[model samples]
Target: MSTKTKVPKQPLSEQLSVGIPDAGMFEDIPKIRRVAGDSAGPRMKGKVVIVTGANSLQGIGRASAHQYAHNGAKAVFICDYSDNHLETHKRELNSLYPDVDIHPRQFDASNEAAVKAVCEEAIQKYGRLDVYFANAGIATGAVFTDIDSAEFMTMMRVNVLSVFLGAKYAAKAMLLTSPSKPHPSGSIIGTASVAGLRSNAGSTPYSASKAAVVSLMQTISYQLAGTGIRANAICPGVIETGMTSLMYEAARARGTEKKIGQLNPLKRGAVADEVARVALFLGSEESSYVNGQAWAVCGGLSAGHPFVPGRLS
Candidate 1:
């Protein structure tokens, strides 16, 4: 025989109440503010980095540049094909982090000569190039029938060819400066997309271009083997950048902004800074062993088809 303590029961209403809040509750979720990394210390100290596709004030390239500066990168060359916002971006970042040298370059990333020149510029100016983020690319949604051959070629030129140039030239620069560092080392990061991993995220050509980008990183990582340099691709899901501004605006106009990223487990679209954080991680020494991989920053969307919590479909 065992003595048992009396069990207390909750009220029926309390027992039956659902723990999950309604989706409406998400409307008031706070925006993610950009700040230095958790420690707010010099994490990328003395590193020199290049970030392409950085003209947009609200883009991952600009955000990554800021992240590098915030973490004490000695130099950050922010390049873009468009010169329109490059100066403005430079000013804004300079105001926040005066110590970080921010160079604004205007050149088409798809042009092999321009890419090579920028990489050489970094090596010439800084005597080292630790990271090169090949982040410049376009977004499109035209379906297969609507897209003509020229359109497909344009997409490939801007997206696939650019990353190829980035890897080829950035690797050369890194190799040139490897002896100056402790080891033959560098990091090359490309901006792929969840669309590249599967269908439904982008138009056919766009998805193909991104898939090529992912494959490029994987191939180059091994090609650069034993050199200590790492190559990786970041596959972002639904991020709120200039590329997706129209989608966000339309959603807001239709009063459906809260539903922006419902397909993902997190149920909210991410900002550029969120993606930038991952770029910073790949660029830092903490990820020295992280190589030849495509990191999905998709808020668990890539884990599988999102399902309702506590239930199976």
Candidate 2:
């Protein structure tokens, strides 16, 4: 059985009423002792990966890129529509994982040509494309009355269309077997949200876009069945990422930080690494049998609404 590493207690002022998986709390590496017939290396060894929406320092895409490189991915292409943080992120990742090839690109993920080009680039350079994480998405809090058609369309284009393009192209790339890749095997991951599963977590357009993502993965997974490729989605709850930084900041300003995720059983908002770890798992061989599923990494919030313990009434 695996054991978790406990963190030392913190002072009251700095104490959190919630908990997160700390540095040593979870094991990301394969077991120290390898089993016979195992790959005999790190979780992502020799894999070529692509992650979209990776510019934000506190975003899941960035964190996932780091996790992939750390886990022995041969190359990780990190991309974002915005270029402001791309170079900086590349530098940081390169510094940390000198052996892993880290490439940063600036492009709109919703653009079919761009998405196709990226997949082709990975194939040309690495001879195989192992994983594609379609994590680029936009969110809004506009109420129904304030919603505009243009804005709503833009949301779908960025969030839903992007994932569609990613899956379409990535699957094509993964199917192309090369000398390095003896089989048609790969993983395609999309970032959905709990908002997609139900209401109250996002605005109309944002939620609709994410819902499309969830459905897209479900259908795509079946389409790729028996191709040695897998398609899946990650529906994250409240996380302290660049997209949700405003909400977190507001709660902190009101000195209600401890109540950030009070509705969830865990009672805490997650960091990017927490969600990124899930992406890493889907991208690796560890999840070889997992396909066509929407995995909710929402601190059990999606299990059901929180209720008073030992008080049925």
TM-score, every prediction: 0.84, 0.86
Model 1, 1-313: lDDT tens digits are 8775443331221112323233343467954432223444677888899999999878999899999999999999999998799899889889999998999999999999899999999988888888999999997888789988999999999998999999988887776634456344678999999989978888999999999999999988877766667899999999999999999999999999989888898899999999999999999876767888889999888889765667764
Q: How many backbone clashes can be found in candidate 2?
A: 0
Question: Model 2, 6: alpha-carbon shift in Å?
Answer: 53
What are the per-model C-alpha RMSD values against the true structure? Answer: 17.2, 13.4
Clash count of each predicted structure = 0, 0
Give the per-residue lDDT digits (tens) of candidate 2, residues 1-313.
8685443332211012222223332366543432111445678999999999999979999999999999999999999999799999989989999999998989999999999999999999999999999999989988977988999999999999999999999998998877777667789999999999878888999989988999999988777766767899999999999998988888889999998887889989899999999998899888877888888889988889666567886
Instruction: Judge candidate 2 at residue 137 and give its lDDT.
Output: 93
Global Cα lDDT for candidate 2: 0.87
Would you list the C-alpha lDDT of every candidate in the order shown? 0.86, 0.87
Worst 10 residues of 2 by lDDT: 10-19
As for model 1, its CA RMSD to the true structure in angstroms is: 17.2
TM-score for model 2? 0.86
Off by over 4 Å in 1: 1-40, 178-182, 307-313
